[model samples]
Target: MNPLVSVIIPVHNGAHFLPDSLASVFAQEYRPIEVIVADDGSTDGSAEVAESFPGVRCLRLEKGGVSRARNLAVAASAGEWLAFLDADDRWFPRKLTEQVALGEACPEAGLVLCRVIHRFSVDIPEWFYGPTDGSAVTAYEPSAWLVRRAVFERVGGFDEARSLGEDTQWLSRAWDLGISHLVAEEIGLERHIHGANATGLIQNRRVVFDILRESVERKRARRAIR
Candidate 1:
């Protein structure tokens, strides 16, 4: 089905990469799309960079967090489907085009995720690679996901309380409600991990592990209740 897809990009002091990310969104082969750049109190002139593009709405908000920035952008958007993109990442030309078609084919899917291509900077250690060849990484990344607008209202937006793993947490709630996901094999996003990414790559492995462990405990508690 052809529908208006609202692309929400949240940024904080990412003037260096916002241009590339916005360029990718503009390069999408899909039509009827709206782009909203949520600037989470960036000191690096990110708002100006986003405003340089025509037809792109730039939202100026306090330094709340990525989740808050995304939620605010979603609230301001006017699309039937919502797609999240971090300021430092980019989408392939057929990202929305392919995902939207896949969504139509899999009508039962609450969200559609495409295969992600990872690019690592020299700073990120080689041992951190998911695969030996480092061909790819997580499928649950928001950049790879195209979610239904209703999913947010149903499962609620990303957890503003938690600084990390909020996207995973929000998506898990939707999955627990029997909302299936359509993971498209087509590569449609380029995720950059430069020791620190707006998406999720913290150099401190222990902190990341703790965040994930919290999710696991919550999941076990839910299972126990059932």
Candidate 2:
């Protein structure tokens, strides 16, 4: 039997790109899925755009943070697999279909990540990171991964305190938990570059990355002790 997948998209003033993101989700060939839009106090028309989507459960929250928004969405989701997609990024039509197929092939693998193609206005960059034999991949976008819901619950949801780098931090923790498995595929995801995105802001707020580094080091230290 195919596993149910919950697609969680956390939006913070993502109105401009929300429609495209939602459309990508709707186009997924995979069935038995629910789309949850966790809106984190969008002052823009994000809420309105999200509400326009039929059957998409929109969980509105105070202006906490993206991690908080993601946690709220995860709590409301009822899928065995959690597939997260940033509002500004989109998947190919075969994204979910191919990911779930990979999951089925290796039932023991807790995480599966695909290759990504970066699309800027000027040019398109083909990026691939994995072993030559395709053992595992290094560095992955959150949009490229399909993780087991239980693994997320056990490791705890995204760190609510961290202002940025939450996706990388969470994936690192997952890797530390000895549940990481990767499958390299050309059916890639497209990462859109835009001004409103959080990447620049995250770098500006160096303190967030500092916090993330400390947490990661501490996790490693604890593991070393055992």
- lDDT for every model? 0.84, 0.79
Where model 1 places Cα greater than 4 Å from the true spot, the runs are 132-138, 198-226
lDDT of 2 by residue, 104-142 (tens): 788788888887665554222222222333232333767
Worst 10 residues of 2 by lDDT: 122-131
In order, how many clashes per candidate? 0, 0
lDDT (10s digit) by residue, model 1, range 118-203:
77765656435454355755467788889988776888888898687677777767877678888777789888777675344444
Compared to the true structure, candidate 1 yields what TM-score?
0.88
lDDT for position 96 in model 1: 92
Q: What value of lDDT does candidate 2 attain over all alpha carbons?
A: 0.79
Note the residue pairs that clash in candidate 2. none
